[model samples]
Structures are given as structure tokens and as C-alpha cells.
Target chain A: MREPAPRSYRAPSTALVPAVELRGLVKTYDEGELSVPVLRGIDLCIEPGEFVSLRGPSGSGKSTLLNILGCLDRPTAGRYVLGGTDVSALTREEQAWVRLHHIGFVFQSFHLLPDATAAENVVLPLFYAGVRRAERERRARELLERVGLAHRFDHVPSRLSGGERQRVAIARALACRPRLLLADEPTGALDSRTGASILELLLDLHRRERLTIVLVTHDPGVAEAASRRIFMRDGRIEDDARA
Target chain B: MAARVLRRHPGRTLLTVLGLAIGVGAFIAMVSFAEGARRSVVRQFETLGTNLLRVRPGSRARAEGVRPAMPLSDADVRLLRREATTLALVVPVARRTLAVTTEAGRVHRTRVDGTEPDYARIAGLRFAAGGMFDATDLGTSNRVCVLGVTVARALFGERDPLGERVRIGPALPARVVGVVAAQGRTTTGSDLDDFVLVPRTTFALFLGATEGYSSLEVRPRSAALFEAARHELTTLLRRSHGLGPAEPDDFTLWSPEDTIRAAEETSRILGALLAAIAAISLLVGGIGIMNIQLVSVSERTHEIGIRAAIGGSPAQILRQFLAEALLLALVGATAGVLLGVGSSWIVAHAMQWPPSVSWRVVALSAGFGTVVGVLFGYVPARRAARLDPIVALRRE
Candidate 1:
């Protein structure tokens, strides 16, 4: 490998730089003496500003793949490059730093802190990133307003409806201005009408900010809305389609 | 954030705080006991003029502290006055607590002191009105007395106590010939102006209970000659008493500072016992905090998952819980210190001693609580930080 050029605010501008590129990515969990392989050899590349949906059956390992992509879990045998950084080789604390700056996660059931105000939940990532108090709060307010939760800043999760809580979670995911956004069934617990509103809000952010997104869901209708879609079967990608 | 977490479980937080406060408070209050006692001893002894010493008939192996002092006679006083060149004054005093009844039948419990005129001058007593009994009065065994201002007021009301008669104990009637001026309050709570004094010659005929006088109150001419005075008195007493080279002298000498030291030595044992109890209490409180924190980590596993998922590192999680523990312990320790200091003040007031708060103990106890918070809080915080993000999130 040749020595790389010193990077700047603008990422290396090769003609077509991929936002996320994984090669032969594999993950295995050791349960006692049994080594359970979750992901087999998998190859995928996502370009910047693309909205990609992942859909599969329950045991198809879509969630595991998303976890690996989000840097919440490590890949056992693979190279994962996100925005020109080889994140797979980083240490655990370094991975947390990578996730803080490059990866955003919105979970199913809208995992906003139950006792914290909406603004507080939004400021969580910035806190880990060591942002100053005034700056973190300012960013929290701006992000909540962007997610259409401007009036719900002080409300805890219990006071917010399913759609509003999901919006807060989405606002939190964008707190650090992450390069890649990952949603694991962000709308699964909401009714279809509320779910559609959340999907619309995410789409608006994606288009306006040109954020690269990877969303996993079992709903075919949800999968069809993405610019690109992938199908996973038994820990391997079976199909990749572009809209 | 740590405060918010504690507020979510008000009952648990209060329980941990109460445990620590009780421990810290007990420790502070107990240490203040020794401090207050020492302060009162200093105050009490300062009331006695400096360069003064007491010589009694027995050695104070008498750190045999509670034993009664052996008696000294008028002959000892005469021997010191005649032979000891370093001595300024030698006065023999015998004392007893007796109820004095005024002519109008009023009663007061007071110390009846039997001594000559030199006793009044050495004790720094001044006359508010009448003068002390002269040496002529002592040599003649006059039935005359001098009353301290407190007893004079209690027994005489506003009437002139001069030439008045008061009964000592049950029968011996002595006429009040003079009144001493008001000496202010003593911290030992004993009223310095609450006694009556009569000539030692008269005291023997009236009380008639003892074989000889209580002890000799001796003073050197100046502070510079104090050691010389002590040596002179010891040599003269031994020679007069006919002690041989090997025989230990029968008399003991007391300086005011020695009395203060003896009092401190007695309180030292009590101080140690209190410290042990306080240490045990704080340890128990620390263990309680650790056990509760362990339970807290397990119960909040899902929350820990959420924190990690949102970009919290293991170190960050550890710091958060550790801060929570410290916050709890710190609050408890502060409350306990205030409680302990307050209780100490009240006890000192009740005992009529000035309240003394030991600030050193306050800092030590609070610092110990903080250390305990870190020591005990570490295990649970580490366990919380090490949770697997996926499994933690998977829990309900």
C-alpha cells in the first residue's frame, strides 16, 4: 500500500468515491464452543448520497449486516471503508470515535431516553464527541427543528406519540452531522400513516443533506421506496437492484 | 446526567445518603468531644495564676489519676517559707463542699475553703468591699469568714453581709468579715465566686474532721525561678520529712500544665473507641452503596445499551456511573457533618463547655467518603461499561 495523501475537510475527490465499501466482510459470534457465523463472504459498495434499503426473512442476517455497517459490532474477516477511512482495523474506542463522526443509528421502537427531554436525547452523540455545552445545545435545537420536532424539545419520550418519538430519534442520529445514516426498522412500531410521515421526514433529510442511508426492514412497501435495494438470504447478499 | 439518574430512584438515593451521613456524623461528633474537653481544661487552668504549683503528701503515681491526694500540714508550709529561697509564698488550704445557711435561712451548696490571707492574693482575688482576714486573724483562730460574691448574693440577698453570720455545714457559725469581688464564669461550669473562705486556724476548730491540711499552694517569686522553686521545695520537703537516699519522697508536685495533660490522656482512650465505631459505620455505608450500584447496573442494562449505541464509549459509561456514586456519597457526607457538628455544639452547651468543632476531622471524614465512593463504585461501573451492545439492547 502506498502512503496516502493528507486528507482535508473535503474527502478525497476521486472521480467516483464510494461512501461505504465492504469486501469479503464476515462476522462470527462464539457461543461456548460453538462458533456461529453470522455473515459469510459479502461484497457491497454504497455511493455517497444514495438511499439503500435492506430486506430479508427473520433468519437472513440483515440486522447483523446493519450492525457491522454501523460499527456497533466488529467484522471478523473483512475490510470496511467508510468515507475513505478503513474502519475495520480500528480499535474499539477508535470505532466509537468513527461512529460518532461518520455513522448515525435510528433504532426500531424509537429508542429515545425515557426520562430525558427531546433536546437532551438529541444532544447525546455530541456529548460523546466532546462538543462544548453551548455548541451541543445549539446543535440539538437546530436538529430537532430540522426533524419537525421544534415544539417537542422539552418533552420526554413518554409524552411524545410514536411518530414524534421517531422524529426525535432521527434528530438525535443527525446530531453529529454523521456521514452515513443507518435505520433499523425506524417505523416498525408506528401505524402506516405515522410511519409514512417518518419515512417522508427521513427522505427530506436525505435529499436536502445528500446523506448516504442504509435502512433494514421486512416490509416490501418500505423497501420499494429506496433509490437502491438489496436482498439478504442466509448471511449473504442474494440480489442488488437500482431504482 | 448523574443527578438525573439518581433523581429517578429517589428512595435508593436517600437510603445510600442516610447510611453515609450517619457514619460521618458519628465520627465528627466523637472527635469534637475530645477537642471540647481539651479546650475546657486550658480555660480552667488559665484561671489559676501562672508560676503556681501544688505540693501534696503522696506521689501522683497518681496518674492513678482518680486517687485522693495525701494531706500536707502547716509544718510543711512553715518549712517551705523558712528554708526555700526560691519560694515567694506558701499557703496550706483544706477544702470541703458544704451547704452554707444564711441568717435568714437561705441555703447554697458551696466549697468552704480554709486558708490564710496569702490564699486570697495568690488566687488573684480582690475585695469588692471588705478586706481578707490578716495574719493576726489566722494566728488567733478567729471565727471570721470571707464570702465569694456568688454565695454572698445567694445567702444575703441585698443586705450587707459584713458582720453577718452564716452556718457552715450543720453547726459551726462564722461571721462574714469580708466579701470578694466578682470573678466571671469558668468554662468548666464551676462558679469561681461561689465559695466562702475562713482562716485555717479557725477551720480546724470548726470542721475538725481531718488530721492535717489538704495541700500546699506554692508560688515562686517570678516565672524565671519556677524550676529553682520546684527543686528547692523537693529538697527541703525530703530533708524535713527525714527521707533516706533510696526512699521515694512522699509528696507530689503539680503544675497546671500537668493537670491538663492528664485530662487529655484520660480522653485519649475514649477518642480511639469513637474512631473505631465511626470507621466501621463508614465501611458499612460504602458496602451498601456498592451493593445498590451493582443492582442498578443490572437493572439499567438496556439503558447502557442505548448509551453505547448512541456513541458512548466504555470509558464514558464508567465515568457516568462513578460520578453518580460520588454524588450520592458526597451528599450524605455533607449532611452528616452538619448533623454531627450541630449535635456536638448542643452537647457542649449542655455540659457548660464551649463548643469546639474539629474542622480537620470534618475534612478527613468527607474525604474518606469520597474515597469509599470511588473504591466501591468501581466494580459496578466497570461491569456496566463492559456490556455487549447487542445483547444489552436485546434485553427488555
Candidate 2:
């Protein structure tokens, strides 16, 4: 049996410069002496202002890849460059700083702080950015209104509707004016109509603010709506289709 | 910010503050008692006179439960009069308790201090009324007695005790020419309040023939000469008593300085013991703070996680918890200080013990409370700081 050749990573065209690039990314976890690889040699590029959707079945390394791109986890072996910074070379605090300053995350479960109001949740990124209180509040209010939740600014996560909560999460991700927005099943918890509304809001933000978006979903409609779609299978990219 | 934090968790804050107050209050109370004792000892010594020394008896051998004294013969007295250079006055005195009757027909027990006119000067005693006995009174073995303030008040019924005749043992009439000033109770609560003074010659003639004195009291001219006077008098007595250098003297000498030093030393030991006990409570209070802080960390795990995720550094988280802990301890310490100081004052005023408030004690206890807060609160604060922001945020 002949061994397979190593996959080559293609760098995106540098016209606008890629917002996120991963070369030979690998992530492994150890259970005692056993090493379980979740992401194996993932090579991907997301260009500035491009809406990309990553589609895969459960346990196919899609979320793991997203985590690496968001600077939440270090790859076991690989190079990750985001916003012209070699993220793999940065220390933990530096990585957190990068994530805080440049990347915004939206979770499938709508992870807004339960104790804080919608506006307060939106101000979280600015808090990490060390923005002064007055400025943070101003920006938070503006983003809340942008998401059509201006009247629900004082509503806590528990009080907000599913769509309202997801909108707040989106507003929070844009708080520090991050360059890239990563939404993991942004409409997973909402009804169809609300899900379509959230999807439309994300598309509107991506086009208007020139923000790069990477949406992780198993839904075909969500993936098809993106400007580019990447399909993953068994910890490897199966296909890349551009719209 | 401090006020806001405190207000946010009022119950925990108040509980912590209470613990500190109890610790501080215990410290203040213990220290005050010890301070009062020290003052009492000083007062006793001061009343006995600063320049005076008491030379009492001892044995050639260590005899347990035995009374010993150098025989104060007339010749010994004459020898002291001639050889003593540092002695401003040397009065041979004796003490015996006697039953006496007054003209008012009251019989009471009293201390009979036998001494000459200069005895009053040496003992730091002053006449509250009338006049003390003179050398002429001692020479004639005058049956003149001086009533102490307590004795006079008890026997005379608010009447003038001066020139009144009092009957001692065998109904011998001793005229009270002077009233000795009242001396309050000492630390041991002893009865130095009621006593009577008379000439040594009178004591020997009327009561019993005493060839030996109980003690020889020496008063040096100045404090500087006290040691010299003691040394000189010891040498003179040793030579007169025919004691060799190899043998222990038959008498022991006591002075205000020695008594004062001993009192101070014992007081210090007692104070330390009390402080140690109080410190144990403080330690317990510290443990209480630690326990409460640990519970707080657990209760606010989600809050801590959120703060950290939102850009609160480990340092900031640590500081916030520590601040809350300190706030609790500080409140407790403040309350304790007030209670301790106030109780000390009340006890002092009520019992007439010198209630001395030591500022150093208050400052030390407050600082101690703060230190305890920081020390005990650190482990929990660190635990809170080390929480994974992701897990914390994910937690309900």
C-alpha cells in the first residue's frame, strides 16, 4: 500500500488580504496514553467580507476547526494566520487578546450572559477591548438598535424571545467592531421564520460593514445562502464550492 | 466601588464584619485588664514611697515556714545612727494587730504599726488631721496613737478623733494625736485601709517587750543612693551581726524599685497570656473569614467566570474577592474596637480599676484583622481566578 501525499494549502488571493487562514491545522486530545485527533491537517482560507459556511455532520472536526480559527484552542501542529498575525506563535494571553480584539463568536445556544441585560451582553467585547464605560455603552446601544433590539436593551437573556436573544448575541459579536464574525448554528434554537430573519440580519451585517463571516451549520439552506460553501467529512475538507 | 461591592452582598459583608469585631473586642478587653493590673502595682509602690527600702529578716539556712529577723537591739539602733551616712532617717518599726476600744464604745481590730515620729516621713504617710508624734513623744514612750483615715472614720462616728483616747490591749489609754491619710485598696484587694500607728517605745512598754524589730526601713536621700545605701547598711549589719561572707544573711531587703520591677515582669507575662488567648479567637475569626470566602467563591462562580471572560484579568478578580473579605473583617474589627473600649471604660469606672486604652492595641488588632482577611481569603480568591472562563460561562 502506498502512503498518500501531504495535502497542499492554497493561500487566498491577497487583493483584499484573507481574514483567516489555516495551514495543515491539527488538534489532538490525549486520553491517558491514547491520542485522539479531532482535526487533522485542515487547510482553509476565509477572505475579507466573504460569507463562508462550513457544513459537516456531527463529530467531523467542523467545530474544532472553528475553535482554532477563533483562537480558543491551539492546534497540536499547524500554522494559523488571522488578520496578518501568526496566531499559533502567540501566548495564551496574547491569543485571548487577538480573539478579544479581532474575532467575535456567536454560539448555537445563544450564550448571552443570563445575569446581564441585552445591552450589557453586547458590551462584553468592548469590555475585553478595554473601552471606557461611556464609549462602550454608546457602542452597545448602537449595535443593539442595529439588530432591531433597541427597545429590549434592558431585557435579560431569560426575558428575551429566542429570536431576540440570537439577535443580541449578534449585536454582542459586533461590539468591538471585530473584523471577522464566527456564528456556530446562529439560528439553531429559533423557529424557521426567526431563523431566516437572523440569517438575513447576518447577511446584511456582512455586506454593509464589510465583515468576514464564517457560519458553521449542517443545514443546506444556511450553507447555500453564503457566498462560499465548504463541505467537511471525517476531519477533512470534502469540497469547496464558491457562489 | 467598595461601597457598591459591600452593598451587593450585604449579608456576607455583615457576617464577616461581626467576626472581626468580636476578635478586636476580645483583644481590647484583655489588654485593658492587664493594663489596669500594671497601674495598680505602680500605685501601690508609689504609695509606699519611691526612695524607701524595707530590710526584713532571713535565715542562715533555708528554713521553710520560719520567721527570721536581725535583733534590733538598742545597740544595733545606736550603731545604725552612727555608721549610716546615706540614711536620711532610720526608724525601727514593728507591726502587730490589736483589739482596741474607742471612747464611743466601739471595739474593732486594727494593725498596730510601732514607729517614731520620722516613721511618717519614711513611709510616705501624712496626717489627714491633727499632728504626728515627735521625737519627744518617742523618748518618753508616749502612749500616743495616730488613727488611719479608715480607723478614725470607723471609731469616731464623724467626730474629731484627734486628742481622743483609745484603749489598746489591757485597756491602756493611747491618745490619738493624728489621723493617717487613707490609702485605697491595692491590686490584691488587701486591707491597707485601716491601721493605727504609735511610737516603737510605746509598743514595747505597753504591749510586749520586743527586743527584735520586724523590719528596718531605710530611706535614702536620693534615688541614686538607694543601692549604695542598701550595700552600706547590709555591710554594717553583717559586721554587727557577726555574719561571715560564706554564710547567707539573716535578713532580706525589699525596695520600691525591686517590687516595681517584679510587678512589671509578672504583668508582662500575664498580658502576654491574655493576648495569646485573644489571638486564638482572632485566629478562629480568620478561619471564619476563610470559610465564608470559600463559600462566596462557589456561590459566585458564574459571576467570576463572566467577569473573566469579559476581560477581567486574574489580578482584577483576585483584588475584587480580597476587597470583599477585607471589608468584612474591617467592619467586624471596627465594632469590636468600640465594644472593647467601651466595656473597658465601663469596668474601670465601675470597679475603679485604671482602664487604660492602648492605641497601639487597637492599631495592631485592626492591622491584624486586615492581614487575616488577606491571608485566609487568598486560597478561595485564587480558586476563583483559576476558573476556566468557558466552563464558567457554560455553567448555570
Candidate that would win on TM-score: 1
lDDT of 1 by residue, B120-200 (tens): 878878898788999998999888899999999999878889999999988679888899998766655667798889889
Worst 10 residues of 2 chain B by lDDT: B60-69
Cα lDDT for residue B212, candidate 2:
80
Give the best candidate by lDDT.
1
Q: What share of the true interface contacts does each candidate keep?
A: 0.59, 0.09
Candidate 2, which segments miss by more than 4 Å at Cα?
Answer: A1-15, A108-172, A185-204, A217-231, A239-243, B1-36, B60-75, B99-108, B126-128, B140-144, B152-177, B180-182, B205-211, B240-246, B271-291, B325-357
lDDT (tens digit, per residue) of candidate 2 on B1-396: 445656767787777777767787888888887887788788789879889878776664676644455576666667877988988877788878888898667988888888888888787777789878888888999889998888888888798888889998664689989997777887777777588888888888888865588778888878889889999888878887877787677777788888888988988999999989888888788888899889878877877765665445566677778877777777777888898898888877776777687999988987887788778888888888778766676676
Query: Candidate 1: where are CA atoms >4 Å away?
Result: A1-15, A132-138, B58-71, B95-99, B107-110, B126-129, B158-160, B169-172, B181-194, B205-209, B222-228, B244-251, B268-276, B283-285
TM-scores vs. true structure, each candidate: 0.88, 0.82
Residues A104-222, candidate 2: write the lDDT tens digits: 88878877767678988898767655677899889988998999999997888999999999999888887756778888899888888999999999999988877899999988998
Name the lDDT of candidate 1.
0.85
User: List-wise, what DockQ does each model earn?
Assistant: 0.42, 0.13
lDDT of 2 at B156: 87
Model 2 residue B351 lDDT? 61
